[model samples]
Target: MPEFKTEPYITDSHHHLSHQDFSSDIEEVIGRAREAGVEILIEGGGEVALPYYLKNCLSDPYLRNMYFCAGLHPHDAMNFSDSILDKLRSLATHKRFAGVGECGLDYHYDNSPRDVQKRVFRKHIELASELKKPLAIHARKSYRDVFGILEDEGVPEAGVLFHCFSGGDEDLARILEMDGYISIGGVLTFPNAVRTREVISSVPRERLLIETDAPYLAPQNVRGKRNEPSYIRYVADELANLWGLPVEDVYFITTYNARVFFNIDIDHGGDIVYKLGDRLYLNVTNRCTNRCSFCIRNFRDGLGGYYLKLRVEPTPDEVIKAIGIPGEYEEIVFCGYGEPLIRYDLVREVARYIKERGGRVRVNTNGIARLYHGVDAIEYVSNYVDVFSISLNATNGEEYNRICRPLYKGAYKEVLKSIERAKSLNKEVRVSFVESSGADLTGAEDMAEALGVSVR
Candidate 1:
């Protein structure tokens, strides 16, 4: 097997940096990790390792990006005492301590009684809630019990994660429904781990993370060797293969997910312009005219690895600076969490800039831009935009009212007018409907046909 060293920077979201295996040569381990581009290392293990992890691993100048999580593992549930809880509570207040756990039921090992594991796990959940920190859960042969406990305890707003996840399809569905994250490790690369691979393929990219779980579960290629953070690229490579995306894309997304989940201090990019495949999308604002029931922002913070929530809307110059050169992409798209037409002047200016530079331009709007501005917005943008992909989300006005909940009255009619105006301007007009958002697809197609426009 080839050495996996492709990504410029990567993160091992779970590892045991203080474990005795690396005690003799821990500096060497970290040096190799840095050489392989592993910048962030999160150390988690049973509670006994917490003090050493904080004092040694985190304080090491060479390991500047180290963080730690403190909790009692289920294997040592019998040792869960008030003193340990007190220690964890104290450590939780420290800024470098990222979360609570590696704590959950371990029915497979049965090292501790099942009832004791449950009781201990509940206490950890309570501690996490009190600290307002995420839970780094470790479950084996106890997915149902873990799910039940989390549901009963009520997941904290900090969120929950199943580390080195090895659950099946039903388990994956339940995890997603709870908005929990799944961290994959070297086990994902094992050819015989069919169930783990299935879960990996089914996990939503936004909710996925990668880890080493090092000093254990080394990748099949390095099966018997001691695993370290440097080997995270192998797990990332396997995930890239499973997702059929570039290795860099896998690193970027999973790294982003881990940072958000663990609240790690890293530059999130907070980009105004981001590229997907051949298209570049501009996120000018988070303000939207419609409150769609199925909008992803209601469930999570951002979309497609970019945090679209703008603290302050970027100027047109800022957007252009982010875009660098527009001609490299197939098209410059005006689509994001909000209605791009709200900033009409900016859109027109940027569109003109891109068009002058030999780049195609498209605007994805709710088609109610005219209603928002009380003018024919399509006509205004038609001169600059090559494609007008309007959101004809519902078949009729009544359905539109129920689904889109537009701020303006008579928005559906205004949208239809906007589509007609675009067509009259000789712009390539396409009506788009979110099929999964309960839109009447057949009716939408017929409506598009009547308007002499394409439907997608």
Candidate 2:
């Protein structure tokens, strides 16, 4: 955390603290924000709050950098009242007043007439322009119309945050060209989330800000439950990982961008993704018997995560506990830096648990479980595991030995023997090759076909 000061400065660029989900423990939520190094909490909402209530909430100094926006949501546009504008005018003059909106079109579920939604959206933008304050917008499935209005009315120079940004490359390009900042949430944590990852990775760090959009879009780690500001770190970590920068640099640039744009200073320190389950990762073992040159753990940072740590290799009970009950994941990968067969009991416990509970499992191996663990390990493991993905980095023994650089003698022969046994198992056994020189691509495929195992 380069901004690794006493506390990381954070500005929660977009959120809806007014939602009912906060009623149970708004103070606890705020406490979590504080603990996570969030200093400023900018509050905004859809047509959710009344103008009068929003005013008092914004006026409270204890709500450090607390702010409000007034707008008729696309769904609530039909119920827009003239008095709401009158109440908003009262707060717009206050210095804490930063923006207007959370208003935009929702073509996916047209809750309000598109024309009515447009009318209300324009009024909010007009209000923002008049106040010279930034505007926070919510646009979805209506980019053309939303941008059309901003262009038509000559949207103010004041900052505009595109909340819940979920668009293709073209949409992002358009918004970036307009000098608009995009706020992202939990969607980035989904498995194989190429689209959101692509958008976040490519977006300029100076123009990027993150939000939990709490009580909604809680993220994959805390999915199917309420979301809060504490989980924003997962978004931060994912973005940091994608950009190939230290989490500290990400915190520095994004938090700064957030404050300047939203006009609030919030702290963002000690944030970590407490929840996990979007990308299925397995920490097979830390004590690898063989030290491959290309092993990821060989790097300094070594793909570290807050929870992705190992004090001592977890026993079967500990590993099973970490895995939780059965059917919670798409794939239970047995591939770790260490050999899966080393902990035969760990696999037996988890595999049995998952088999009885209807879950999918996979084993990424060096294709030599039999020699080390004995022939029976494969017979029993194949009974419970779903997929066995074997690494075939080379086509022959000499190359395999050269590449894997195995410690044990005859490791290559052991790999071939393991593959042969796996082919006869009840699981989908496959051999794979990392693109390498002396890698007989076609010959490997032919060999795989003969072995009755899929080749990648």
Candidate 3:
């Protein structure tokens, strides 16, 4: 909103950049990361990146500021021969390399012999200590054994990081006591990810970092699809809500922690968002027609500094550009702190985007589009809008004028006119009431009856 060139980057301290999920074109992976503001992406622990460290693995990977952590996955414990350990240990010496082992016991899948897993995991712990660097760990249903080992073995001087942590507050507090930074993943975005949210809510901002764990544990929208570094916005948003801070603030704290903890540099914190959720809720402008009492947007700014700031109300093309590709959401909600109809053309353009993609569009308005954006607004709705939930604050101009307190002259009549048009153009229209005593319910019902539009 202020026209500041916000840094659009982040550091993913934990991911398998070398897994087959990225084999097709790793360069594109890096490029996409850059586009999404990811400047430095640290591999959780990948043998795939080892070749890049082979002096000729890939051009200047280490010097490029990209990094890798090497270790045997506990699931692959059976493959942990003396030679493999030697190979991983060898890569640990690379300047671009940081930390060790995403390797830990997986009680869920004891694919590797328990004894073998334990032995290999300890070897990685020892490697972290010997190398004097951190150890990136993977603990799944085996926190007891994992934490016991780290506590016994003495966490490496570079310290420890619990990668893609899906643990409880107790585990988090224990890990924090051990001086380990908790890096969270897509699990935090799941509506039912209660545990992840609990961990997020309890942890201090300074102790967290966000990760895609790409090619795996993909965040909600991209579930089953190949996850990438750019989708971190969803994760960041969820964390921001959990901590009651802004997405930018979450990114800043996590990125700062990541940069400091991992000791990698390259501007990891700028416009940090976890994953781009389905509805890219854009507050096209903060200028609302109705002064709703419950509006978080009105009281706060841009949903936790998400840059959802609609300071320079964008044109429809700009809205479409901000919406880019139209596939990001189940529907792009035009609801913001203010009325979207304030920029009618912009709403039309965005609706067109969704219609083209066979996507849906929802416009949360005070039933005054015809008045604000003119007759053209309802015309656009006939074919473009799949669903519209309008605010029917009152039945007549007097009550409507009093409740909504619209600034536009004759605003009450304008809303009634818009509702009439909305009913004609959209098949699915529901006029909502705010469930307040001040509203005229009987009059609202009468109006809904007359307009053939149900009032809620």
Candidate 4:
């Protein structure tokens, strides 16, 4: 088999570190995982033996990044006792204990009576809610029952994860409806797993996560061998192929999802300014009026490697500091996960700073600024912004309404007026259209022509 290249970063969202299979070579296994870019590992501690495993393995600084979830597995539901439940509840408060479970029902094995499994699962759900922590679930052939149980018990506000999800469209719809996350594993690479692949394709990118259920479900390429955290790169590769995104994107996104889901502390410092080639892009805010079908924020936080989901919007001074010596780049552009025009004053202030420092300024907007601000925004922006690249996503008003879903009722007409106004002000205006499936590109181009602007 060809060697699988490691991504820049990856998080094995689910794995079994305490499984007796790796006791002898656990150190080497962890080494291999780190070398392969598995930066974080969430060990599955559903079985009673997990506390012992963690006691033995967690002292090593090298394994410090590992976190574990404690709960009863359906397979162990038959052996469920108050003593075991007490042990799990104690472990739930451990500093490294990230969540509750690997705890749902598994009807395929029938290792435990169906009624027993349901009762044990309810306890786990209640524990998660009481402790305010995420629930990592293990479900197989019991998706419907699991959903019903979760509904009955009321899902924990902290969140729920369907670990190593192997479900169909109906299950996926239900999971999404509950705002639950689906962590996929090596099964994604199986040739016959068509239904799982469809679930993968349909899942919103932000809700998607990757895992390696190590020592279990090794990927198709290494089917018979013992799985390990190092093999998470293979799962990420398959996800990239399924999503038609770059492997690096899959790595970063899954890692971000894991960090957020587990509430793991990592430095996200809010990259306000990012550079691509000669252009510098400033991310001032995440607020936007339109929920466009093709917007990247639906899939991930930011473009390239920068995480643009700002916890707090930056001030003009902060933005200017982020753009220090702006003349270094060919042009400084105001564009980010949000519509830049929403923070009109901030844009003007920062644009003035860049322009004073001999930097060219451009603004990428969704063209509803006028409607958003209830004024002639183009006139104000033209004074400071040298160029305007507006999104004319659809050709006609009806098409615009369907694709952009702007908050304003007559947003499409406002966009057309904004374009004409920008041209009248003699500002360098360029209209861009994203080629979504079924978008009327010809009509969009004709609209741009009518407005006397170039289409990009």
Candidate 5:
């Protein structure tokens, strides 16, 4: 195998490395994975042979980089029993056990009764909840039932992952809405997987994972061959193309996501500058002017994959230093858990630095700067900002006040004024609304149209 020195080290987020097919040369496969720059392997195990593999396999130094998750596969749901659950609970006690699945509904195969699959999948959900481990789910032609069961069972607090995801656009939306992560495999590289490619491209890299599903579903380039962790690069390459990113960016983003999802050790200490796709986002503050009901930080401290809850906000100089070279990214975005305009000075400083260095600058704001800091605030920032992404969030002040709950009265009017002001300056301005918030999307669009700006 050729070495991948230039590519970033990646993780095979889900794989059956312990399957019987690799019994003859498992060690050599690991060696090849290492050679391919695969730094981590998440092994999905739930078969009867797992005990034997655990007893004898983990002693290898290579296995140290491997984490394991165990549960009954949907095909084997018929064999599930309380005793098997007991065995799984025992396995969960293992120091290396990371999650509780590779289990869900697979109606396409029907190897197990549909009812039995649902029941066993619920058990795995409960077990994962009890064990405080994330879930690695398997759903094939069963996304509806799988999502229904998850909603009914109450998704595990630890987290949930859809392994080898092959869902449609609606399914993908539902998964992301629930903050679930999806892992893609070699199927992405298939010429006929047009739907898969389209849906996967819409997924934020922060919510994506790459896997090879070894001994099965090898990529198009190696269609007849047995898949292994080393082939994860093919999946990464496909995802990179779909997301319009460098393959190394996909590797870094997905690997970071996998580590965070599986609760693996990785330094995610409130990143000041974080990369998502080709844009670099600066998390300048955790403070915001409005307490929007749809804000994600209220439920979780992270977005996409990076931790955004800052204990201490970075100085403008510190942020500039963290950014390294501004021109390296497609755009430097002033967006994070908080509204960037809350620190209008920091935005001016950092955006100026980015713009001066031949980089494009975009500010994601709540449009409250004009309300608090006066008209000049927007005018000054407009000088350096290439684009303004303001959150309209609602159709009118009544709805805005109810949904956003801004600290000041007439904040919605100020937001509208800010949008009009930005447009007057010929700034590339777009307004965004949260669909899940019961916000009036059509009204927001009309408002944006009246203001002569685009809606995002």
Candidate 6:
């Protein structure tokens, strides 16, 4: 029932509007994609007319939402030469150029000799490395050889994306090992794509992106039909189902990933306040006490479509002004890309203001404020903070230290002490444990129970 409230924030990361299939109706296709909420369409697949078609798209109002990549396809590897590389270098300087290639080996068709394919693929790799751009690779039944060539060539410093990836878990592991991203397409919706469904879930959300690979692989609903960017919602739907999230959530996550992949800047000017569902979260600062192994900031700049990497830490007045009508949200939370308590005075001021405005307040913290402030920091903010959600990622100090990597010694003990102080004040409190951190969830729950607080 939860549908996208606006044009769905889908980014068709790999498409081929230059393909002859859309030559007659390209304008209509672009319009339909815009209507469907496809915010971006990264046109790729380096065919002969790709450069000229992309140039036209850049100037076309209907295709303004598109970005492009240029290179030689494996099928035309025989045509690869210095002149083509020179052409690619010139194209790479374009303002709208997002990446280098949709180039790699495709043994499935064998349109070009395997030796030539490998040779040209290496050239593209070297070119992408020299240009410092991400490479959009296409490998079909040649992932083993493709990965081998990449390992030998040294992946581009800008990054690499295995687009329309159909590899198994081992191939995925290799991609991840190389710190590469993989973009899934319509194949995910095929009833027979059990391997993909089972394997893709293991991909870290931050490292994952979605694409339509239009004019090629169409989702089950549009099977055997000419695919276009508008149908990307089907791929999003499948990702949503696999990730057990709302379709809109998949749209935001994948859209954010695509933007980060292509280095698209979203200038919202350092969001002091952001919304997720009905809760308004205050991004008071980008400073955290612990470098948690499972922290989202380690992977991406933003979360839930809001860029939390602040240009400057917001003043208390800035945060309060941003939360114009605090009571409109279910609750105003002091949880952002960083530790709220690190800015304890700011948290206290903003929380007090929200509480007076009939707005409920929650403060999520690593619970090490007492050590930093040399006082009962939890109790200091307890009057205004209605609920305290603290991180209890591990049961004991040793385990906590290993996972959180806090800057201070005895920091884990301080976290436990802070929780005790909150409970003593009779504040509503919950301690959280991250399952993916490989910590003992049962131990954390038992520790929280002994402290008379609920486990989140």
Which one wins on TM-score?
Answer: 1
lDDT by residue (1-456, candidate 1, tens digit) is 111211236779999877878888888899899998888888876664455556666764854778888899999999999998998888877778889998999999899999999999999999989999999999999999999999999997899999989889999999999889999899999989987887789898989989998899899889999999999989988988889987767776887788889987534435577666577888888888899887876765655445666667888888877777878888889988799998888899889899999999999998887667776667776778999998888888998888888999989998888888888888999998897787666667788899899999
Each prediction's Cα lDDT score? 0.84, 0.69, 0.70, 0.83, 0.84, 0.84
Superposed on all Cα atoms, the candidates' RMSDs to the truth, in angstroms, are 4.9, 14.2, 12.4, 6.9, 6.3, 4.3
Q: Model 3 segments beyond 4 Å from truth?
A: 1-8, 46-49, 52-63, 266-456
Using Cα atoms with residue i matched to residue i, what is each candidate's TM-score against the true structure?
0.84, 0.55, 0.56, 0.72, 0.70, 0.84
lDDT of 3 at 279: 50
Please name the candidate that would achieve the greatest lDDT relative to the true structure. Answer: 6
Candidate 5 weakest ten by summed lDDT: 1-10
How should the candidates be ordered by TM-score, best one leading? 1, 6, 4, 5, 3, 2
lDDT of 5 at 87: 91
Q: Write the per-residue lDDT of candidate 2 for residues 1-456, one digit (tens) a residue.
A: 211122245556667777766766766777787788776666665754544435444555444656666566777888776787775677566666667777878888888899988988888888888878788888889998999998998776786889889887888898888889988888888787787798778897778888888778877887888887777888888887898876655666676676667655332322111112332445545554455555654542122222222445655655555556456556667755567766666777777777788878777777665556565566667778888888777778777776677877888777777787777766788988876434555588888888788987
Q: What is the model-wide C-alpha lDDT for candidate 4?
A: 0.83
Residues 137-244, candidate 4: write the lDDT tens digits: 999999989999998999899899999998888998999899899999999999999888887889987788899898999999889999999998888889889878
Which regions of candidate 6 fall more than 4 Å away from where they truly are? Answer: 1-8, 24-28, 48-53, 59-65, 266-280, 304-306, 315-332, 344-360, 370-384, 396-414, 435-442
Q: Write one digit per residue (lDDT tens) for candidate 3, span 318-409.
A: 55555555565566677765677766766777787778987777777776655554555655655777667778776677776676667678
Q: Please report, as a residue range, the 10-residue window in candidate 3 with the lowest summed lDDT.
A: 266-275
Q: What is the lDDT of candidate 3?
A: 0.70
